[model samples]
Target: MATFTKANADYLRNTLQEAVVKCSERCLYQSAKWAAELSVSLPTLPSVSSSFDADTDSQMQDVDPPPISPAFHFANNDPEEARLEAQDLSRYLLAKSYFDCREYDRCAAVFIPSALPRGPLSPTSPNSNRRTPTKAGKGKGKDSGVITEVGSEPPSNALPKLSQRALFLALYSKYMSGEKRKDEESEMILGPADGGSTVNKELVGITRSLEGWFADREARGLSGSNQGWLEYLYGIVLAKGKTEEDAKRWFIRSVHLFPFNWGAWLELSELLNNVEELQKVVPELPQNLMTLIFHLYASQELYQSTDPIHKELDELENIFPDSQFLKTQRALLYYHSKDFDEAETIFSALLHADPHRIDSLDFYSNILYVMSARPKLAFLAQVATATDKFRPETCCVVGNYYSLKSEHEKAVVYFRRALTLDRNFLSAWTLMGHEYVEMKNTHAAIESYRRAVDVNRKDYRAWYGLGQTYEVLEMHLYALFYYQRAASLRPYDPKMWQAVGSCYDKVDRPVQSIKTYKRALVAGTYYDQGSSFGSGTTAGEPTGVLDPETLYQIALMYEKLNQLDDAASYMEMTLAQEEGPEEDDDDEAGGHGIGVTTTTSKARMWLARWEFRRGAHVRAMELANELCQDGVEVEEAKALIRDMRARMESGRSPS
Candidate 1:
């Protein structure tokens, strides 16, 4: 047996005390193991005493020992008993560390034995007969003395509340890992766990254990910080199980109590979509982390101007003067701000520093493509394809460059390769759909868009693509369904509303078409008002100059509904749009004559016929004469003229 010497006792006491004070789980386990191996009784650490000097006392006032949890207490003074207690504590700590690192199987193995009661063994103990007979003896059956029936035995050791909690967490981790693997294989975004039977059991166990812990801590009036940590973990579990709102409430409560919890801050930022809110609590976070949050905000396009992003980047640069990551982020901010030239300059420097930076490569390719720098884009794509062929983003960039060049077949190959590398690459899926649409493969386009939606249902682009594909196939019902879904997801998008309105018209629902077109006009008006230049329309105009095509469609729908007055009103609006300042030069020729000249001719002839029917002889004659000036409508105008002249010559009142 090992002797418990004074020196060993002192070393164990100091190490354990320090471990407890630092809250270092790994160090605690090591110290506990050393004490058990040496059979040393740990001495109680002395209480911190105030210094006699007033100045020193004030400085040392906050140096008191950390409070120990009840689970960490040793009830015996006997050396042998203390050694056993230390061994148990070491097991607990080991189990906790494994759990924290997400090694669930190891965590479960260590925790089950440490937590459950262990009974003393007799001659017929389960451990004694644990070994099975060899395979050769299997054919001999019971006569060969092979162990068969394994009976359950009661545990001698009582389970601790903390151990029970750890056990539940281990099981929960295992369940979540399984779900994550499934999501990866299926190319779905990682989100809340599906309610599988096994997962539900684990969730129930975790919830029960957590509730008990909360109850116990509250009853004992424990430290609020510890309770806050509990809440944070509870929030994580709830979030994994798809209870987002519930999880958000818990995260808010956690940060309120423990303001320094960075994990809580990050989760809250995502839930609220407001990184600025986190600054109120964690003002002194590391510059790298702060820059990352700002980058995330920029990526989400949350800021209308670059002022706020530039300010944050400037502050970060001041703190981390030589940080390459911050420099890359600054370039990204420039790109988001639409300063393409400045962004290109910064990205060029970054790529020069590290030629293989994937993010820089991705963003630079996109910038060059947007700028119509075709030669540079092709060069970058070629170099990236040669060097980083396996990277999904590289493949995607190459695919995009080819797609821009109208090389649809070659682009499809690279896009498919990107998807093979990362099935949930939403951009790849969407780009592939565009390629298929360009190739005139409506079926393939629909499939690609469907896959995109399967990966992320909230992807409005995917829904809109599906709607377009269906509309092209003349599947009005299907088009209407997807267009409605897309509109719901992005109600501010006028294009989606227009698509819905067109689908209604195709299905012969003129009233619904009118309503949908009106909705589109309202959305367009708001969009223009919110923009600096009215999105290519006259600033501050009512309805903000709706798409000429949309206006024509609305007029046609009104004609179908036999509301000729409204139809004429809308036709006049359409003709006026063609003569607006933004009119294309091609309108002078008949090449792009879908606007004023052609549409107005048709509208005028229809209006004349309607006026003649309504006994408005003068108005009908004037409209007919205007139509007669155009050779294309001369015969129709002459026929209308003859009818109006005959009606007037009868001298029977215009009707």
Candidate 2:
């Protein structure tokens, strides 16, 4: 648990240097073997010293040997080259060790210029150019083809340079460490005195360093495999701030450079709005990358038919026949496709193989519920609750089963347990809200939904739940706000649009209400026949007939606006879709009394009023008489008839 800091710099430096020396010795030994095989006399490498000194002046000097004859030649004796290669290899080892130890800050700190010296031989020093002379040699000898090992001192150009790849990793480590610290600090600070500012500052510093490295690479006109990674890292940095477009551009460039990069592909896929955008890149991607894209497609419900997904899954199965991840994905596709038997079979086998697989258990419970296999679902819930009570998914499945059985109190207990396991479990929060709503605890429902939105703002279900709870409480303005948010998250969901419209009407925003209703109609019709099942309703709920109640409300609004013709048109449409009244069973129930009213009677009353407005008094009077005799809207019918009579007596003839 020891933290990395400037105090530990010496130890870090010494450890890195030792690793470099060891790797260099191994490389030299390999070169010597190669030299022997080539029939060349390599220089007898000096014994690697056990101790290393950071200060140059304190180092023991090597004994200078007699110069070799012209016939004897040494091969590969560049000390600077060996040292540079050794430093690169050593960096990898050191980084891996630090990463394994979870000391990411130390891993990053080791690659900085101040910690790792840039130049072993300083050009500013006069001794840097000086060469030691042997007892038998007075001046420099003629140039020979022989390569000899230099002493421990490196040449002026032999700088301890860090590659951009290493620098990128350093930035990544710093960013991850900073984020972890930020989360921890956020949890500790009650009053919130901005403890995260320090972490943000660290992130900013790392981003600036990456930018500087990118600029240096550009100026040097360097383009290679590392270029892709550099761009990808830059994209990650840009994504941290208000530079999402720039981030996207850099990710695209990274993809162009390295098409095989799964990281870049995944990031790019997230930025895209739809599957069409993904299709443009699909052909260029490898099969493994295609599987990732297909997974995205499946998540978005972009596949209209299972054919394409099944084809892709077949290809993936060939590549990784025993991959549980792929098998689960295939099962999910089957579930979505409404092949419950197939989905259940695969999920059951997966659970049998790994009983503790929470995801499998969750999905299996869902499939069982959808299939109405109540006994199976209850058994699964009991087993999961008993064996894996600590798992959030297990609690969620148990809670869902109880909720379905209309046991709201028992359901809330399990849902709250799931939330206790992970406060940010979005599904549990949303489901708990549903249970609260069922229990008629509107305030608790609101709190649960608020927590869910806090966990993930993009979850449309949480926002919709908040809207519904607020609307039920007659908080129209608050309901409107959350409904709009839900609509933004799921624009294609007609239910969200309808909720927004209803809120608008409640708040007296008639024009906005009308527009939103039209949008709801369009959205409802667009996917009316699609097989995609939403949580709000059963599969393929009839959308051809507009909500009769909504149509009637619209008609009333039009009447208020003095748009008589439009009112009549909408009322006619409502009547056309509305079902006729049922026969009164006078023997079984209390007879149809004076106060009784029916949907058919209401439609007739509205139609009669519209007829009166259009000067069709005869038809209006006939409908009004029929409603009054049937004891349906009797008072309203009498009032309408009285008005028609008064009008006729006043000589207001039919127009």
Candidate 3:
């Protein structure tokens, strides 16, 4: 819930680790083990004091120590050689702790100057020999677990002192305690440090701090034309700050000065891994600005990374804790991060800020999308309805979002709303047609799709949609006509070709259907600039049997020719594929090959019918009875049974 703002604050906290390790000899030795233990316990919310003995100020006495290297012997007087190996170990521990706690700004703040001190350079006066300790620690810690800062000293020619490991542990605790030590320090420091020397190299290293300068300027309503600030920022980024602070400051300033400057925003955001700030800043700019911002954000969000924007946000919060725009900014951040909960929290705040706040609509819609918050969508609908009720596009978009979720009735309501607002909203009419089709209201779907085509002859989807609805309704002629038109618009889509084949089959045109299917196969390969393969299948071959609908057509062809056996086989195949096996195949197949038996039964039924037609009563009776009992062809067999029984009962020539 806490917010960070200023670059310097964020920088200092981020660099605290490096600062702590530089403090004392005793801390330099013990901080590593202490820091490692603390890191493991942190996620469990362990009490900080219990994780390490905060009060241990005495030197640690070990059972065995490593032998001193030849470099550490009195034989070497080089400052670098005399440097204890223990110092490097201590710095590593302190830095690790600061990083874990997300106090990156502090870590950088401490690390930059302590590890690499710069001669103090005032903006107004140039100097050569002077160095400024802008913000320095007080003394080394003697208190239990507390880091006492040794007072600020002149810039030394020797290697800069690294903080003791315990120092960072102390700083982190101070930060969590809600202490305002840093803020108090910032207020007391009136101007640049008293160093007269220009240390451009190290000064350029503090990125986050410089970024904060620009953030501050924007917050104060100062525009980007401030040349002095611009030059300073460009310098830091140009050098690529040695600490995160240098980078952070440069980016923040650049973004704040030119909110519409997507290049600057992107570079800065990328470094901090914070996109939320850009999200907030985008809507605040002009339409052109928002457009550029959208393109940039969308492009960058495409790349995957786990770095949380919350770190940058924390820094932003600390700097502008009381800004009225903070809520909107926070909400935008949450939305981009896909954190709907936090986004909603900030959106609620924005609404409180202004019930009619325009950005709230977008924020609410985004949350709805992210969280599947349908109720929030309804709320968005209400808001749009209450405001610009005559915006057809608005209503259409709202409707489409609902339709995607399969709320057809609700979708229709919005689609109708859009139609009422703009009589010529062809897309809305088309969408309404689709919604009706989803509800199985074919008549309505047809009318709506027709209206869409009538409004815009080139609306291919609308034409295709109409053809589909007609096909479902068994209007093959009409389906064919619409499908042809749709195919002409998007000639490469194999689906359109397939639909054309289906319509041809429905009209009892097998040759045409086969031709259409062949065309579909060709189109499947090169159509729509898409993959040629069938759904869920590979590209090697177009496998699988003919579609059920096609099989039905084949059966019809056999029936027209009086080929009962062939017709039955095809029909059985269709049924088998559609509803699975449900009938006795033994009767149909007649104890033979499935194909041969079907033909044999056809021949037997024909002979029995012929015999009954003649007046030879004995023959008719015997053959008909035999055929009827066989039961291979149910319809034909039943007919023979009726004829034979009637002939016997009549007793007059019995045939």
Candidate 4:
């Protein structure tokens, strides 16, 4: 009996410690294991025989006096308090096991023996039945579940003083269980697709109940040491409902006190949409090893790099040596920089090591499409299909194959198929928009781009596509809004600036147009110094405005303002800049590359016409004769010369 009491007390201590330190999947397993090991009823002392001799009974009273409860010992100065604590610990064991094993419905049922199928009982409230859990330990017992009726109820006169640690675990388990069930329901709605996100009314109500509990506890000064975790949970719900700042505060508070909670860090990271927002909250977070790791992880998700993050990657490698995940990030950074040549070697080595890994295979397909390497894309598609025929990534690759072949309809079909499998596969929406544009289905294209933006506001591809579609439809106002949005997201991309400038011109805002075009000329300086802009700088927007289209556009805008001198200077500047990103190209993803927009002869011709209209007859004649000598724009040059000489021969003042 003494041994049993000590063992049970030790079990109680271990459970509480584990609950406080790490009570998610690991706790669930430990609790489940305990339940299996201690499945029998609590040990009881044998009743004293009624037929003992008078002397023996007298001696028994002296030698072996009636024992205190054998397997329910607790360290409380008050015997009653110890007994109550011990009883509560015993009663909650089975339910904790059920919850840890993800038998949530059963977990709740066992929470209160008196209340069937209605708990994860409150430690403070006699009736509240809220519970939560992280998503894990999916398997449930098949038969003879660890417990049916875990234990008898405690006396009503004195309620069991359940440990706060045990109660929190049960609450978290149910939360996780709620998410798991929601996913299952979503998966069933449209075969593979989640039809939409539905509010989990159950979780919302639980959170509402806990709010009052937290308030009451604080009022009474009974809110325990574990309150930080509760705040973290509350923040998660707040974020889901878009109480933006409130969620950040709660997460900040939780992590400041409990820096190792990875989920809280991740939640906080997701709430911050940009560097400015992230920096605002960083100082408030704990300066610890886990927080350091969080920074390394979160930076990749938040920023669109103007340079490769390989330096950060290398720093992280000091801690996570030879990490596969780090290698993948390095490869992705190269891909982002559009440095396919630099990325190619790393990707080849990765593929050679793990031929079936689909981590960056979709990107590989996109690169192939850009290069017009049709055969290579086909081979990639086959490998992706073999790996997982129904995967969204595979569908994206197949879609790219059809796109490269100019089968726009086939490409759209596959892209749509990818969406059906996973609506949040952001690239599918953008890719589908591209195909719709090819098919001249403007309305469909608009809808696809809008959906992509809804999924992720950082998706510059979708924003740019929407701008282009609006421009095509002559909706310059709407086009300008999206172009500006894309430009804000990718500030160093001259193409985005150019789009914004050109849209301003369409709307007859020549001053703004000229200003924006000039910004594009100096956009490269804004990129990180000595970084990998070489590969990532999309062809037309090469590190600087190498193609000089921006200069030409600035000159055109100046002409619109009737500023002939500025226009002539900009036109001369255009000759000083050349080649890129060929002038004929549209956006990189969907261009035919047969463009002639920025030929030197075209700029010269425009400059000559503008000079002549401004009454500079001598300069116009000089430009016209030069173009005619080279046979470049000869017909237009001759026509210009005829008009110039006619004006001179007629002897009227040139306009």
Model 3 regions more than 4 Å off: 1-390, 527-655
The window of 10 residues in a row where model 1 has the poorest summed lDDT is 530-539
Q: Where's the lowest-lDDT run of ten residues in candidate 3?
A: 51-60
lDDT score, candidate 1, position 481: 98
Candidates sorted by lDDT, descending order? 4, 2, 1, 3
Work out the TM-score per prediction: 0.53, 0.57, 0.27, 0.67
- What RMSD does each model have against the real structure? 16.8, 19.4, 24.6, 16.7
What value of lDDT does candidate 3 attain over all alpha carbons?
0.47
lDDT of 2 by residue, 1-655 (tens): 1222222222322322332333233222222332222122111223222222222211112223234334332222345434544566577568746755778778777675333221112334222232221122334311121111234222221223665445555666666666666555545211253222323335445544554454344344443324366677667655554355566667766666544344565565555544555566555443333234345443534323346667756644542345566678778766654567788889888777767556657667767766666788887887787777789889888987887787889988888778666655767888888888888899788878887776555566778888988999999999999999887766665677888988988888777877787777676654442222224233443424555556666776677677878878877666655432333576343222223237557767988977887778888899899888878689988998998899889988644
State which candidate has the highest TM-score. Answer: 4
Taking all chains together, the TM-score of candidate 3 against the true structure is 0.27
Q: List the residue pairs that clash in candidate 2.
A: none
lDDT of 1 by residue, 115-176 (tens): 22222222363332222222224332121222223343211212244432343444445444
Q: Write the per-residue lDDT of candidate 3 for residues 509-583, one digit (tens) a residue.
A: 766775676566565544122221112121222223333444444555555566656655655555344233334
478 Cα displacement, candidate 4 (Å):
1.9
Clashing pairs counted in every model: 7, 0, 77, 16
